[model samples]
Target: MTEHRPHSATTAMGNRHDYLPAAGRDALLPTYDLLTRTLGVPRVHQRLIDQADLRDDHKILEVGCGTGNLTIMARRSRPAAEVTGADPDPRALSRAERKAHGLPGIRFDRAYGQELPYGDGEFDRALSSLMLHHLDDDVKAPMAAEILRVLRPGGRLHLVDVGGPMTPADGPAARLTLRGHHVAGNLGDNIPRLLREAGFDCTEVATQRHRAMGRVTYYRATRPD
Candidate 1:
């Protein structure tokens, strides 16, 4: 398993300019594909995919789809399902679009997790992976509400993000990382409260070791029927 390193100080600073030079971006296309493709197949993603119970008639939305790693995997997992990948990063979207080009029944869009452009009750399932830690509750709470608004009654929302007990040993490192970018609020402690406030019934919550030193936590909930 690849270790999940903290983003560079520049990326941590949230400076879009710090990402990479255009030439560097061009160089990373192949690397991005390899990483996302491999990561998307792991047990964690498979669990979320199973929970989604995708069907031919389902309209699935993937927020912060990044380079469409999970988007393509989702399509492959449920070939007949309609899948859309949304991300605020144009560069990432471009890469995802290219990867999705020859694949039918899949699309990419420019959108933020906090503000989705789709209609009300337009989707059967909404998903996000590895994205929440980058946002605070002000952004994530409203985004969670928006996910519910667009989901059909009884539809599900599957989210995977970083949340765990930050030990005293981790405290200094975690704080250093936070100086550059906001880690997703600790959903491990807050997800249940947030779900109830959003009017969704929490169906499941679990944590698993992701790689060597990091953990992946998930929350699966449903809109009331």
Candidate 2:
């Protein structure tokens, strides 16, 4: 299910960056939801939402929110919360916007995780699901720092991504896709290490066995008060 659908974008400073599409390919974009659902991402999304402990008036941000599945779910789970999902993929954002057309208190933005378009301390809570591993190694820390900057003091970040030591139960594809250089270093304790380097006090909260994603670890990273 791992697709290396790479795309390019230029920042205001004229720096070019690459990003992977939601489905790894433009042709697979339409079926992104189907693939995610088949992989039990919705269930993982709910767990992340539950951990977020959303409240009324909370400004929630989801980074790399492909197609808005988790955004829509958070909006539905906490109607009073204003939810925003940011991603670099326009086609995926379009689909997300359409899927959330009738939903109030929710919106999608065309932006990258590392270069969020929002103001400092603009959000009370942030969520990321299976999106961290999609980033390039060099982009990881900056994205973490960006998340820290956009969150109010004491705000919490709920994140889930591929991680941990590999096991025999993991399939070959999962091992191959997740063990890539860009991905391998981002796994396991390195996640917390990355967040901590960005000034967040992070702790591993839970872990799950993904059918095709190897071990998935959940972490709660808190911006200091």
Candidate 3:
């Protein structure tokens, strides 16, 4: 059953993308953070890190470290580990770098998921939260291959994004609002098989949630030795 509330206002422009296209990233950063909090991002990031299982010596990379929330968390969790956050957005990267000040082994750089700046087998684990869906259908496989290429044999890629449809219980308004978001696209595609074809061995998948996002999925895939 839908949680009872005053009917969601402005249900027509229900998602951040609608706002983003009009006002741009500078205006929407806080809005983005607010929605992330609504979806319980701290809890989400915690679970994501737990699933990552970082080793003491692990060299980790976050492919789309947008506001650096997860990147910061990963660095804090393993102070000795080398945690690097690379993103294509200069504005976001600058903000993340500032927020990550004084953290040893945490660096931010401008880079895209498709053509990462790192050399092969340099990292023990890679993370991409809510980022894969940005790539077009033809690009996603190559992006996955790029991620696989940067990791060492057996290196793990920990990811989370939208999944299949919402449960039958989900309200129509909820579904309509999320239509253009990353989750919807993922649910419609054969992501695991794409990863497998990209040379990753799909390890695990499970349904999880964010406060703002109704239904998302977690995935773990590793580069085979």
- Order by lDDT, highest first: 2, 3, 1
Per-residue lDDT for 52 in model 2?
87
> What are the runs in model 3 whose C-alpha is more than 4 Å off?
1-24, 165-174, 209-211
* Local distance difference test scores for all models: 0.69, 0.83, 0.72
Q: After superposition, how far is residue 16 of candidate 3 from its true place, in Å?
A: 16
Q: After superposition, how far is residue 26 of candidate 3 from its true place, in Å?
A: 3.1
Better of 2 and 3 by lDDT: 2
Model 1's TM-score against the true structure = 0.77
Specify the highest-lDDT model's number.
Answer: 2
Residues 114-148, candidate 2: write the lDDT tens digits.
77888999999999998876666677888899999
* Residue range 1-225, candidate 3, lDDT tens digits: 012111121112333321111113456665666667776767777888999999769999998788788999998999899998976556676778888888889898776666677899999999988766555555576678889999999999998875545542455534654667444557734567778899998854666543356666778999999
lDDT of 3 at 90: 61
Candidates ranked by TM-score: 2, 3, 1
Q: Stretches of candidate 1 above 4 Å error?
A: 1-11, 17-42, 164-184
* Model 3 Cα shift for residue 152 (angstroms): 0.2
Better of 1 and 2 by TM-score: 2
